[model samples]
Target: MAHANDAELYAQWLELLGWLDAEASARGLSFEKVADFPDYIYRMERPYDLPTTVMSVGVNSAGQPLMIAGVSPRHAQLKGVSLRLMGGSKHWHLHAGTRGLLEGKRPFTRERLAQLLDGAVRGQA
Candidate 1:
């Protein structure tokens, strides 16, 4: 079976977002932030359908990469990990919306997203 690492997953996500932003930008796509959700959620209506996080967010300019800014999924939360989707309140803080980036999002089916992340950061992507 095929395998994926966190870095690779993140790279894939980055690449995927690059493509999406291109399209959304042309269509005047907008953003919204939601409370209780870390930034990866586009819509909470589909909570059970969230993908896994590959790597923690770094830094960058807005309107560039669609970002779902939020506390790490493993972080402490009263009820557990927050599932905030895009197009809600505080979503503006994110560069790329959660759903925006997740259009093609899915947990690494083969390898772990963490490994992919290591490779990407090492310039293997």
Candidate 2:
């Protein structure tokens, strides 16, 4: 697929947010969209040490998540939406049709995001 334009990227971000919301709702978790940043924060309750789950849309060096790098195909191919593990610094990339952060799972839909979130909340992957 071609690299998505900023508008398209933003649309995808919104779609991902919708998925995350549905997932969080199902799990009785809290999901909030961060206006200042192209990210969402999921708050986990007690008994779980992970107080917050921050999932940020992967942005380019310009700090624009909605940008499609015109100069680097590398960035286009490798970049996508991403989420980090709670209390961990590394981020895992999420491609629409490929296996994502969770082993053997693809985040091709919003439901998958929720599934990944569930796994994350359960301390899996």
Q: Pick the candidate with the highest lDDT.
A: 2
> Candidate 2's residue-wise lDDT over 1-125, tens digit each?
43444334444555666566566667666554333231222223434221123324222222322111111122254445556554445445544332222222533555555555666556564
Model 2 — TM-score against the truth? 0.50
**Where is the poorest 10-residue window by lDDT in model 2?**
64-73
Q: Which 10 consecutive residues of model 1 have the lowest summed lDDT? A: 76-85
RMSD of 2: 13.9
Identify the runs in model 2 with alpha carbons over 4 angstroms from their true place: 35-79, 95-107
Per residue, candidate 1 scores C-alpha lDDT tens digits across 1-125 of: 23233334334444543433343344454333223335444445655323443323321224432334342332332211122223333221111232322312443221232333233334342
List runs of model 1 lying over 4 Å from the truth: 31-125
Please report, in order, the local distance difference test score of every candidate based on alpha carbons.
Answer: 0.32, 0.42
**How many clashing residue pairs appear in each of the predictions shown?**
28, 0
TM-score of model 1 relative to the true fold? 0.27
